[model samples]
Target: MDNIGKRIKHIRKINNMIQTEFAGLIGIGQGTLSEIEQGKLKPSIDTLYELSKHFQIDLNWLVMGAFECMNLKEYEYELLRKTRELDLDCQNEVAEFIEFK
Candidate 1:
């Protein structure tokens, strides 16, 4: 599976969300979510944020693979803004660096 796919699956499982249920919460078709989880397609930035909101995860972590899993606040309106500021692809590399250090 691609990085995006793994991230999606990881977050979903971490949150205890089933694919079908999570897809509903994210307002996407389960088939599409499944494809994304399977690494068949890339999600747009908007979609990424939506999933982050649904999962209450750090947007930057979700997109770039930076933090393994950010514990985002339920009502943090600015979380998305902070998440967008992070450079794309920073999450995965950051996670690795954190692990190595």
Candidate 2:
């Protein structure tokens, strides 16, 4: 797999999300996501942001494979990951808390 594909695959696997499910979450087709993972296709910026936001991955890491992009705290990453599993209201509460902080 290519760099981007490798990172995408790693994030998805670590999150325990299947390609079809992940694709659906990202508003992409399963086939498109599969092709992306195979390095046969490049995802759009919107798609990249969707994946990054949903998976709580660094956008630079997702786009440029930059592991050193940001020094994110483990708890911060955990919070981001868990937030995706929350319902909209719960997520809004978390967002509001962050904003208030």
Candidate maximizing lDDT: 2
Task: Show pairs that collide, candidate 2.
Answer: none
Those runs of model 1 whose alpha carbons end farther than 4 Å from true positions after fitting are 68-101
| For model 1, the run of ten residues with the poorest summed lDDT | 68-77
Q: What is candidate 1's TM-score against the reference?
A: 0.59
Query: What tens-digit string does per-residue lDDT give for candidate 2 at 77-100?
Result: 556667977999999998899899
Pairs with steric clashes in candidate 1: 64-91, 65-91, 65-92, 66-91
Model 2 regions lying over 4 Å from their true place: 68-101
Report the lDDT tens digits of candidate 1 across residue range 1-101: 22877878876775688999888887778998899888898777777878867656666656666543344443342345445556778756655776999
Question: What's model 2's lDDT at 35?
Answer: 92
Q: How big is the positional error of residue 92 in model 1, measured in Å on the Cα after superposition? A: 29
Model 2 local distance difference test score = 0.79
Q: TM-score for all predictions? A: 0.59, 0.65
